[model samples]
Target: MTLCPSPQFAIPDTPCLVLDDGAPSLGESLHCARDWAAQLPRAKYLVLLCERRSHFILGFLAAQMNGMTVLLPPSRAPGAIREILDAYPDSACLVDDGPPPAAAVVRNCRDFHPIRSARQPASGEVSVPPEHVAAIVFTSGSTGRPRPNPKTWASLVHGARLAIRRFGFDSRHCIIATVPPQHMYGLETSVMLPLHSGARVHGGLPFYPEDIRLALERCPGRRVLVTTPIHLRACVSANLDWPAVERIISATAPLDKTLAAHAEDHFKAPVMEIYGCTEAGSLASRHTTQEDDWLLYDDFQMTVHGEHCRVTAAHLAEEVELADVIQLKTARRFELLGRHADHINLAGKRASLADLTARLTAIPGVVDGAFLEPASVNGATTRMAALVVAPGISEARILERLREQIDPVFLPRPLVKVASLPRNATGKLPRTELLELYERQVMRR
Candidate 1:
């Protein structure tokens, strides 16, 4: 009925993993949980992360077994991390080398030893209720900020089980993750999905195009690739024979149809996109090789009201208002028009409006700036554009700052130089109206 960390399908003598590289066995993973629970008996909540995917899986599962709340912010930005820590009150943080600005730290999964060579604590068991707070996930709010939505242990188990059935994964599946485990998509697919479905996990978040090809080459087996749509296009364009992959899953933002088609044809693997967020974890995934219409979650119900998407009596939340804009046909089927808020979808990656604006505002050379996603030919969504201070900064230099902070897709395509952006009575730019400004300033130009 629940996740037991049962590595029933792991290949015998098969190389499993930790933060360093390939370094743990199934029993070793469980043992890590026992040691962690023992070390921090008094801590009720923990936020743990290892730069390695394997350690993340270990810490998260260990926390579940130990009955602690885990906080997951979509981005690793200091602002987001600080907010999560503040919300949790007093909580121990689990970390590897890359840590948040916060104080509490745990053993780096790579270097951490078992605290004992010959003793294993008796397996600790905790009862989990569907209403209990299992993990907290943060979403960039429409009002240019972050908000947390909590999910239960039951939700994760149900979501993982449903995805495995839809994707045809089993113990035979070996996954290489290009996305960080912080996001709901990566956490579910790379960590919980692998553990529950009996799949093996690999390390590192591949950023460059070449690293993806190299990662694929290193791991050999029935491989599944977990990545965002932005990474998918880059890897496909890298002009390398991608490793033998069985399935590819894309999330974060919406996928370009052309890129999806190209990926399947080039990699000779089925390309699928997940319709999900930090709030719901993963709701649906449509096989790009087949159709764009997302196949609804078998375990959850989706309801579209007005321009907002809401769920009733879910494994995760009730009366949950999602950040996604959906068109509902029935209880289980729907189409995504766009997100419900300020977060923009660019080539299947998200750039927080606040993060973008904050960076532009921080650059001393700038006065004021705002980013926009313009509407395009036959209304096929176009690239992002920005309105920046006309005085001190050159357009080329301004874009460089944005590129360092956000993804390439989110960078202003033509770069508009203007006095300032328009705002409503309360100083908000509606999504529909934001595109109008892009049209007048950038697209028409």
Candidate 2:
């Protein structure tokens, strides 16, 4: 499908982004994009390191208009940024704050002054080729090294349209996302949704519970919170009065049912979970509190072969093989068992590392935690271990609570206590970091 310049619901005066300074009209955004594109350095790719949503939106649109593919690093870590630049030597970095990263060329987005003209730019429709590479988003590297996945204009736009319909929200909704724009879920929901579906997004990347509430309160009408399970739990525990919210969309990591229930009750809004990865945008969604089966979005089909599953959609460049072990419930619905790599077999008792981690976090007083089965050494798997964040609770007490929930065979051999898990921006625990922490805390001692 050819790209549409703007959504039908958006007019020239419609707010594309809601910022603390002021909302930028759709027409104004177009004007800014044009101006920004003209000043950007000539490059095949532009690494978007913009923290502010407004800057990210402008930079992304400018790159698209200039035929320069946007490159979204897996994280804002220095190493992650350097790896992308090294891999794509023809790319330039567009940063919003501080010194621009080391690259062939660097463009500070803050330097681009917005047009002070009261006159709006002509919002003309521009068609983008279906096969045009729009972006390359990297995986979170939770399981291994981060890998780049290319997204075409057609695919990104199509995925956004599918989400718009699936969520049953329109331009009237204001999106306040806690996840950063670099992540796939953040890009698809916060960036792509507003640009393609006419919804207005909050410019700030609110993290703390109070900040999120303030951002939501600033919206004029219906509000949608696009966040992860970590943010949701924090909000639910904050016990602060929340503004009216139309819906809460969560992704990244698996959301616990109890947390979802608490969030729904606290915010008085339904909590929805999206199942997808970097390779594919959002594939399916389900109301976490009310449903166990995930309904696939339009035009997407899922097929199961043995223990593995593959997904195909009209907008996808090719079929994507999923890492999750999904149990097909119906033609267009499925249940997530766990990640294929998370399955464990010890003493003939099978368990999922994800499940174990979830159980660990569920224990009273436990703040954050993870279950890791370190890589085998000399053909022998290391005993399963755990890192927990329980302030007052001892490791033995945490283990006692865990034993009550899980089989004895699956209990952590040496439960290590810590302040927090090494979670990335998207609330994903990278295995490499977890292993390092484990070695430092348990093995060295």
Candidate 3:
């Protein structure tokens, strides 16, 4: 909340982003935020493309200095970019090297420049109100359209401090994160933790198992790898001598118990899995091998309401409904029961089926449509299937229009021509029937 940067945090006059190794320093990167605050108006919101760690952190802090909200869009995917662009028409995209090819088609680019001075912003003694929305992050929406969730600076910091305590992050620690800095989990752990603790963060999203090992090799002293279950599995499978790696954090998707066991056995490091989504920064964390309850972020309260999980965030000063279906044990700790019906899983990532269905059914030519996964008829088809209703539109035209909006994974296969999809009393769906319908209508025929 304090506008003045922490004294313990060391800021060098040198560049944060290294062109040779493509690694950016925290101080140098945050300096860009300061520069932007000085340039932009006090109330202008900034839309930052989270392609790299350097750009994400810089854009975030810059918004804070300017007292503007920051919007972080997931990388690369055109549908994801278009959604954010449509949502925030007045926002400017922060493109470091060059504006992304997809974003270029949407609007003119306002290029960002590196900070030249070390002076802090004018609001040195300011405290961001707990109610103020500091940033907006979209849930990856495994089913339909991605939903935007706004988070206050206080809430974000509160969650980060809670994470710092559980993970034992301190000034002496250095991290090499494989996760993108834009997403909530990655943003808090990789960027906020460093600024909060005055620690160093190696800017890299190591993709390959060997790359993860190399990142550790490049960074010394209490190196932690913030990654996913997919990357963790690959890292263990690589069987590299990664003695320098002390801690590992997995998020974004569910971590298999079998893979967690394999990870600790091979790496001799603790595998800590964080639970939460873009909506709630991070609710709690449980160690892979330990039995300790997920230490909830300070000021957070959880309650199971019927089949859904709800949260009372004292930091945000608001109550939020979470996608997770949790078993309420107390206001703080509880076991997770996968996702709520708000999201349906297909091909590893979760999508918003409700949002997709709404979009398809709302179109002019389409009367009513249901999007479901196609079953494996002869056990040959690998992807899910869907059924739609468009009496006048051709299959190619229907697919083309939907493709312009939704991610490819959510795209319906075979484009089953249907009169109308079955809807319940509240126009709802039964999970089993949705899958069954897919099998009968699309798979068999």
Per lDDT, the best of the predicted structures is 2
lDDT of 1 by residue, 264-318 (tens): 8888888888887666678787876577467687777777658877765446555
The C-alpha lDDT values of all candidates are 0.66, 0.86, 0.64
- How big is the positional error of residue 317 in model 2, measured in Å on the Cα after superposition? 1.2
Give the lDDT of residue 272 in candidate 2.
94
Cα TM-score of candidate 2: 0.96
Order candidates by TM-score, high to low. 2, 1, 3
Per residue, candidate 2 scores C-alpha lDDT tens digits across 39-156 of 9999999999898888998899889889889999987778778888889999888888678655448878758976444767647344567788989999899999999999998888
**TM-scores of all models?**
0.71, 0.96, 0.69
In angstroms, the error of model 2 at 18 is: 0.4
lDDT: worst 10-residue window of model 3: 11-20
For model 3, the stretches where C-alpha displacement exceeds 4 angstroms are: 3-32, 36-43, 103-132, 330-332, 342-372, 375-445
The best candidate in terms of TM-score: 2
Q: Candidate 3 — what's its lDDT?
A: 0.64
List the candidates ranked by lDDT, beginning with the highest: 2, 1, 3
Give model 3 RMSD, 1 decimal: 11.8
Candidate 3 per-residue lDDT, tens place, 1-445, comes to 5532454433342223322254444444555566655665433567666555655666677667667788776544566677777777666656545556355322212455743345433222335665667888766545345578888877776777777777777656777777777677788888777766655677556677787677677765677778886567667768888756687888776666667888988888878888777777777788867753566766678777687667777665567787766676666677765555546566666665556765665465765566654554453334545677678987788788888888887787767877655532112244554555656765467
